[model samples]
Target: VQFSDSVSSLGIPLNRIGTTQGVTVSLQSCTNGVIHNSGWTDNGWCGLGSRMFFQSTGTHTIRAQVREDGFMIDQIVLSPVTYLSTAPGKLSDDATLLAARVPVLTSTVQVGIGTNPSSGSTPLSVNFTPNAKLSGGSLAAYRWVFGDGQISTQGLPSHVYQSTGTFTTTLVVTDNLGHKASNFAKITVNNPVTKPGTLTDTFSSGSLDHSKWLASNEPAPGSISGVNYGSFVPGNVDLSKGMLCLRLQQQQGSSGVMSVGGQIQSVVPYSYGTYEWIMRTSSTSSTPNGSGSRVSGQVSSGFTFINNSQTEIDYEIEGGHPDTVWMTNWTTVNAKQYTSATLTAPDAGFYSYKFVWTPGRIDFYLDGVFVSTHTVNIPSASAYILVNHWGTNNSKWGGTATVGVERFLYISRFTYTPL
Candidate 1:
């Protein structure tokens, strides 16, 4: 988007990053290609622990190539329009309430808004879409700030509302034309307000690393069950930093009576404990088409947690179901499998899973809260930790899925040192 060939500036963002730090910038010819030169440099913006830079200016056709392993550039637009000021639409008393995964406060009265250059009583309120993801809407062009007693360019921003009485807020906005406007969205920012976890758990050497936890593979199926377990994958399970990364590769064929794709177990398996794992699952196997006898990946076979006490406590997270997580614990009398919890979209991003076992009850947690819990210790036998990413008999666990091929659980930190 070249505005003026003589002098123009483009706003490009780093979409993704490769393993390397350096990125390459290229200039191509475009229809409006009458420029002296075009190139890109670091703009100096960082997000999610990623370091990136922007170019000073751009025109014609510009492309950025990352020299390193995991660098990706997104929205490399060549334009002359830069963000001058944002549209400070209706503000709120507080905006942070709607931003948290689990809102600490349940009331909408606490959301606040402030002006850019707060002057007087500004209308700091905003209208939002249904279910109000926050207190504001995308009505404004540039931004609809819920200010932080400071100036910000982002829209629908959240702030650390005051703890005592209501706070005086002023809402402000700047249009793309560099024109500025101001308003006051008032409400009370009182106590019981929460902000992003700004304070890391103060380290005193006792704080453990997030990559130290362990994970295991599933148990081998039996002959009577016709379950084959020859895919003994060593080095597939790893514990580092503080996470349990599980990666299993089951060969394509079965080993006759022995079977293929063996089930590996976790080195540290206990009945009663809290466990968290961030898993990314994908398979080299083909996805099942809806035509014939379908074949999905063995996501269930990808990762499994068993009761080390033999009570048959199991948390079988499979890609077979995709959205739902199946959990079951064995009963002392019968070793029948049961469904524990089935959730939605269980195969994306980082998930922190937890399992808690007591004398007669067992529980499972995803992210943080307990999704489902099973009462009565089943099996009554000794079990171990297992994480096996394998293929089923003709069609592995689901047969048509690929996320089960290489499964990894990135455990950040487990606070089993219960107080």
Candidate 2:
């Protein structure tokens, strides 16, 4: 905006003329197009309360550029203006402008903060988002002070507070006009309940590493009538398309006795850690003409097994109950304990199941979210990791496996981290 006047100072008048929330205006000398002053206002008309300065001006074009949307100009007023040598031409606050320039603005930008898992044990990880609204401007900068002396400038950040106590977190946002607003939130951190494990596995390769895995040729335990036991078939266990596919195929023995399924286990053993699997499963009901009797579904599982006293931790997807998952831990062959929850069947797609084994407890998770924690009879001995697809003779556990039937389980990735 250019104006011709004898007035020594300039006020290029501005207003919020539209519904668009944020609008910013910058005033600069037309001679060199250098910005002299800029400000933002949500309300209409001279909300900045300040004037632009130019040295000894005659007829000058003071450029008014909309740095943000929804700002409108009414007119340029030439008034007598002066600059203090102390602050130079730097932009002043609304209080300073009210004392030296036009009427004061009624409001400033509003800032707010939101967090996820807002409260948890110490060493808690929290995710925060800033919600700052500006009428005549956009966010130019962000400052986050996480109550604990740590700071960040990211719009959204995840931070882990290592100590236990209550803290007040603060956020400050600056607009294009150099206006700042602040907001704060309280986070309560308690003594950490769970520590992280040290081992992790994400299957990114096209084939399973033989050095890490071995097939199980033994029959499933606690066998029932009308069900065939499983033996490991190397060809049935394959890694292709970045997934480990374990298939249970009913095969007639050379003596004509049909086998139930297949299984694979880790070559190494882990005593205590966090173990996880991303997988899916598929099965079918037995045929009407039972060359051999088969049940409706199969048992697909990811577990840890030790033969010493037969210690185990099981993430078993029982086929008969399509949507339910069973979590079981055993200290001996005869002593078994379990809990269950319903989940969308993996056959529909992929799902994540995990368990954290500590000396005194076992924590279970589904898709990175906590599900259940078991404190009774947690396995203390190291065990080999195991994955299998098989059928039990009992209809209550796993539907019986029928001759000429097949079942499949696909594991895309397995991750283990020792605490």
Candidate 3:
């Protein structure tokens, strides 16, 4: 049995008239879906609602029950109490079997680019249509739940979705009877933001392209098609399968090789938009002077007022360690110097790499973790896509002479968006 009490009733007392029967009660407050308070209370695994939010002068339902052996004791006596806004005697003089009715409401929620919740990391908001009780009444309130296990106890819920994909959302409501009506909303989150026009490279099975990547390496002739790549099967990228890849086989080219990567480009140009893409690479070649002869890729992502030099960024996996990856950002059209970051990883596992390019801001990521960011104002310019295997020409990366016995820099896929 359940009863309604004053909104300010801190806690209501319930009676279960059985000594051996185990009783259980669950008090669910209107929330988004996160379990803050236990909602259960007892001396031993049945009483846990000592600190839930409750207002005064409002009706609440108290459910009482007796459990014999994990099952409810139907014949057991359950007594519950309730409080009301007005006197019970005057509920309605002509009312015979009064049933509580709430207002009918139409609700609508919105997400930025797409509807699926699982696509890319981005900001999203939810709004509801007008909601009011039938003519003389008003809706008590509305509550929402994020499939990721969060609760928003309000009429409208706003949130930044995590990652990308489709998710099922729930909206629950409570009226004066402690009665509830729930509705579900389907949402999909996708990164509709386009990528940098000059950035080239597709993910593969430990390599980029079908071993068709064009690279330059005289000191170490860069090989294209090999087995040690990221994608060994076609269509490995999607919601279910594998990730993108970029591979580079230790090259044994001529004495001084230049450009050494396979390039990919965007279909359109973006002046001051945010650009994003997830990348994975490992530096396990352990070759000599490997740092100078980078297994690197570059691009020009965004532009601004003084942004004259094309925005250039790099993903370099040198030959020295074959297990560490270095990322670099250049002031393509603004600042003249270049900024870079070096990170280590778990030997043979895949990690996510992200780059966000804006007018005065250039950010870098390693497996979604922010490592470095820059701010430089510059004018936009025509950018080109380029990837290379320049063998040890600059001392900035001078370490190994060769990129070890590795073959092919496999590339899986590329994505772009502003978050």
Measured by lDDT, the strongest candidate is 2
Alpha-carbon local distance difference test for all models: 0.38, 0.65, 0.39
TM-score versus the correct structure, for each prediction: 0.36, 0.47, 0.33
Quote the positional error of residue 31 for candidate 1 in Å: 99
Query: Model 3, 248: alpha-carbon shift in Å?
Result: 3.3
- How many angstroms is residue 76 displaced in model 2 relative to the true structure, after the best TM-score fit? 99
Candidate 3 lDDT, 285-349, residue by residue in tens: 33211332233321111112112334555555554444455555554433443455555532234
Clashes of 1: 93
Is candidate 1 or 3 superior in TM-score? 1
Error of 1 at 241 (Å): 10
Model 2 bad stretches (over 4 Å): 1-204, 222-227, 251-257, 284-295, 308-310
- Per-residue CA lDDT of model 2 for 201-251, tens digit only, reads 454576667777786677755244343445566776766545677776664
Each candidate structure's count of clashing pairs: 93, 15, 117
- Better structure of 1 and 2 per lDDT: 2
Question: Judged by TM-score, which candidate is best?
Answer: 2
Model 2 gets an lDDT of 0.65
